[model samples]
Target: DLSKNNKQMDKIQKSLEAFLENKRKEFPRFFFLSNDELLQILAAAQDIRKVEKHCSKIFCNIMKLKLGEDSNSNQIYAIISAEGESVAYQPPVKARSEEKIEATLTEIEQKMVETIAKKLSKFYSEYDFTNIDKSSWVFNDIGQVVSAFSQIIWTELC
Candidate 1:
């Protein structure tokens, strides 16, 4: 039963795809740009976060054109309008809280330290720095290692 249901859904999806393909051919101008192109355009012109809003507006406009000004279409548009209005009405808050900012910084520092440790661990067994003060030498060694690693794999590191 599950397999049959899945096959039926797949058939329906294929049929929908065909219908959309036909519509796309019929209205080439409206579907000229692919989704990636639209995303790139929005990303270049506006903040990345605003891309979603732009996409939603585009979708709603297309839906309105397809559905025309029927009662059901008006209802759907009204719902979309309300949601857009609500988003616009909301007050902007700080992007990150103090705790979250600190946590992110801590995470970044931990990763940097881990990377340095992993890179330098092989040297530990070969050389003896046991007599040296860890605070001074370890930091300096890490900096050198990181700088060297960054130079060698700068593209990958980024």
Candidate 2:
């Protein structure tokens, strides 16, 4: 009594269930691409801003899974507690100050850094650091990304 569309839907449903079952068998815990793996993927991206495209096309295929739905970026300073002897913008505070005044990446920011790292590693076999460029959003917002994501990963894991 099924129409062609119904039969097709039934096939899709069965296929998805089978795929999910296979995934469970493959990865005992949830599978996450490692930091290195992520870096490779990002490094290989033709346009870093178009990272979503590269990720969706390449990594999704390799991982056989979906990526996080959102991508966000921000800016933060890398505070230096003690300016080097010859560095500019010297802080008023002396060296070894107990103020704990060094830069700390926010929870969400850290997660983004880790995510980027994991994605970029997929493209670069070695130490690829295209995200370090100031012209790129990833580099400009690296600190914020690191801070944000750190908290996220911690909450999920711990």
User: Top lDDT: which candidate number?
Assistant: 1
Clashes of 1: 0
**Could you estimate the TM-score for every candidate?**
0.23, 0.20
Provide the lDDT at 17 for model 1. Answer: 65
**Candidate 1 RMSD to the real structure:** 20.6
Q: Over 4 Å off in model 2, which ranges?
A: 31-158
Q: Could you tell me the TM-score of candidate 1?
A: 0.23
Error of 2 at 48 (Å): 15
23-60 per-residue lDDT for model 2 (tens digits): 43443221244434334433533322233332232222
Cα misplacement distance, residue 64 of candidate 1 (Å): 13
How many backbone clashes does every candidate have?
0, 43
Question: For candidate 1, which ten residues in a row score worst on lDDT?
Answer: 86-95
